[model samples]
Target: MPRLPDDFDDDTDGFDPDHPLADQPALAAVARFARMLETIPWFSRVGDRLDADDRAAAEDYLSALGFPGAAVVPVGDWYEAADCAEALDMHSLSWEEEEHLRAVAHETALEITDEEALDVALSHVAHQAASLVGPAAVLSMRVGGLDDEALARAAAGYAVQACHQAALVLAAGLGAEHPFALKFRLYERGRWPVSITGESFNLF
Candidate 1:
């Protein structure tokens, strides 16, 4: 039998792996975000051309947040728990202050393009969004009482909408690997607010 790690997500809802899509939100977000990136000409053109220091900083931020490696741990594998973690990797941990700045620039600014010349840039955008899933899931699983699959589906929806809003606002291509639903949800629009049961971060 597999000795599952403590952090491994045992989906309370029992998401089926044969239909991985049933529980995989990050994959969907990546796809959808990638498509969004293709729609913007700016992001496509300026893809992945960051200066060394900036790139290092961005990589470190994500690494510190978490990424896969021998020393690094998997996000939603056999044994992981839902917790706010400080563990991060060296790739993106090179600098901490620039994390948000880098995410915003790669995701929302004129640097994002839809040009074929920036394939690597498009990939980076997807990677960044992908990085968010693990951390987001960790926060969500305990707070929202969800597993990776449910969190993923929710994140996909949220990410797509967020990216869409950002795209319309900035007029740039945002890369993602998984495509998301384009429909509007009443809850998200503030037309269907739910009653809070306790002290929480107010996850939907």
Candidate 2:
């Protein structure tokens, strides 16, 4: 019964609270994307760390987006979707690039014992990789461009990096160790890859 601003379109004529503005196509697209992200299995695990109020708020936000159920999906299925491939910009890499990235990842992973250390290392490696030849040098290893040995090394490298990054975030007061699967999503969004074989990125 309350009035919405000029920015919002009335929902009665088919109102969608999640996307009250009909003109902002990008926001509408983000609403859809958020729906997909909420369905990711690890999202709930991440949500479990939230306080009751935060959890309730998250649920309300998702419900408003028209995804009241927000069911979780298998990691593989979600990662393999056509949209994911597009989002990931799946690609291949040369053996030389793979080797270089693996070596860098190996060195960084060796000294990291916790998430904070790992995050700093991840940043350093990403910066170095970017300076070399952009993200493809490392991201290629996640999209089917490396041999088994190379891929293993690549995955290990990124896994450690992701674990560390997630740790830092959790310690910053979330009070939980994030699962590797969830961290993997964060990694990809940051342009880091999970594997060259489209497998789940796990630390163990």
Candidate 3:
């Protein structure tokens, strides 16, 4: 639940915090890319602490090659609602899904008790997993004209993938293991279109 800076969403006259960095084009580009990567759950939660050290190493390496004075600047929390909206658009998610994800992101961001955060996040993951199953079944049926047994396998596979993605995101955000992560890990070594019912089927 990383909160963007207070001024980040204030779009009065298009004031962007990182806009001034344009004066230093190279650093500005690096900063923009770095900040975007930092928005990734695992990186922001667990990997960000090493950013300064990584930068120092990069500078040292550059200086060894006769390049010097590569300054590192603090990018701060620059993620915004617009950024989330755009990401949802890229994923082809509905507006309702976008809003729900945003809420889940914010909830994970709060500095609340660990138990509370884990509880809430896990519940969200459960609901998301359940919601994916029917859509998965429907899509497989429509596109492949699969029978019930094959449809079930396709649906289960879809649910597993969706849950895995959600679990990874929430787990990184919470800095803890998610139930869906465990489920996905167990199935990771298995073939795709895993069986949901007792029937064997080929996805082909």
Candidate 4:
């Protein structure tokens, strides 16, 4: 499984070990405009090496980017609890779903003998594919009502325009096949609703 860095200095190539870059007046102004593109190992050889904090960061960043129901976490032999969600304009996920995803990832570790440990790592990728972006405000099973328009198909992710650009970046990284990617790729197509404060966004 992928482990999240305690610090973000692992790859200084301007790569987001956590989430995608947003149009921030500063990191604060851009708090809810971030986007995270999950990789698919089934399609290629990507989606590994991240931790819970990384997940939290990704979620927080995605929320900042206006993604509904986005959650971030750190991957490890065991996943860690993310602490920067509120500051990033996001909320934390529920322990149940968090535990569930970790367990699912860990169970799949048997096939990864050639590689190091990979349950939490694989979960990060799978969780994204199985996850519902607009379905809750945070970790809730409820749809956050985020529409496809926010995804910006013209950008990175799924939409028609992003297929070759953003999607390719993930394809080459996780080393998964295109079909596998299609399952989890986020769509930024149409319009949607907005979320208010004091809401609990947990995934079932």
Candidate 5:
């Protein structure tokens, strides 16, 4: 796993208190992910492009982390458990989905020690890494003149790897015993986090 930069926790360098997203935990999480990418050596290579070795390394690393396979739960089951009911309503989930999310949230809260830390780590993986790295990989493949098949492979591999990297980065800061690390292992194996104490909600 890569170590975060020494200045990783220094949020005052260019911070603007009045910025709209400054106070938003979700945005802060995303910003942290970006900074990780910018400062970490592994992500520096990833930013250039994900190649065969990168894919292989990701597979080996995730396997070591016990990434058994895709989670048994459907992708939709990993709904965000936000702090506010109003934020939950924004998803427009069906009654069954809403109930299921709440149930999962309740279960997760019982299982984990620090839901907030887990939420931040999940935000880094699902929101920042999956959303950003996958598309970026696809574009990089295109730019490299790879074909559609290669492009698809690169995108999937890099995205999954990026998620693993995000989790590991958090682990570096929060300690390996933290929920961030444990939940990430569960996430990789498909035991998705259903709830967290925050305004940010994960839909996919």
Candidate 6:
């Protein structure tokens, strides 16, 4: 099972808003957005083909959260690697590929946390990163580019960093001390979480 940081107080049953680590601006923004999302039933609209009104409502929510001039677009579908691997004839990333991705993700994580609206930006970047991973892998496997290491590494990095940011955002919205929070901490240490069982995560 995943463990919290040694410094975390074990007595707390859930996220303590008053906790020092919970005082981040990013976390606060995400928490507020999460609450708003719940109120508006945003998650229910996720897979639906968003109509004009749905798009407007989403944009309005984002604008209120300090993202003006941003547009909300619908994705055709959402699937994790495990979900579509067989259909796509996909295999796990090679050891070298994994290393490149992890290294890049760690570096990107450090860079993104410094952004002004990290909570929002990170989520967007995470999606973009996920999109790139498949293409990058396919390209590397089919016709490796000359000196493609940089591109490959970058793709891998963004993918992992996306997972890290997502975990953090989810934890913030759920509660600062939720199991996802532990996942975030695990990512911070360059560890991968394989699964969630009840209140704990299975880490690798």
Which prediction has the highest lDDT against the true structure?
5
Number of the top TM-score candidate:
5
Rank candidates, TM-score, best first: 5, 3, 1, 6, 2, 4
| lDDT computed for candidate 6 | 0.37
Question: Model 1 over residues 35-72: C-alpha lDDT tens digits?
Answer: 44432221111112234443333233234323312121
Give per-residue CA lDDT, model 3, range 1-204, as digits (tens): 112122122212433555754333322322332233222221111112324544444334224323344343222211221122123332322224434544564455343324454455445554545554445444544443334554354445455444434443333333212323222322221212121111211111
Query: lDDT values of the candidates?
Result: 0.30, 0.33, 0.34, 0.26, 0.38, 0.37
Please tell me which model should have the higher TM-score, number 2 or number 3: 3
Full-model lDDT, candidate 1:
0.30
Question: Candidate 6's error at 129, in angstroms?
Answer: 5.5
True-vs-predicted CA distance for residue 56, candidate 1, Å: 37
Candidate 4 residue-pair clash tally:
55
Candidate 3 off by > 4 Å: 1-113, 149-154, 157-165, 173-204
Each model's TM-score, in the order given? 0.26, 0.23, 0.28, 0.21, 0.33, 0.25
Candidate 6 lDDT by residue in tens digits, 114-136: 44455454465455445544454
- List candidate 6 segments past 4 Å from native: 1-123, 127-174, 196-202
lDDT tens digits, residue span 84-197, model 4 = 211223243433332343344334323322122222333343344334332221211113322333232211222222222222223123222222122223222111111122
Whole-structure CA lDDT of model 3: 0.34
- The CA lDDT at 84 in model 3 is 24
Clashing pairs in 6: 105-157
Off by over 4 Å in 1: 1-114, 153-157, 164-203
Clashing pairs counted in every model: 46, 2, 2, 55, 1, 1
Best-to-worst ranking by lDDT: 5, 6, 3, 2, 1, 4
- By TM-score, the better pick of 4 and 5 is 5
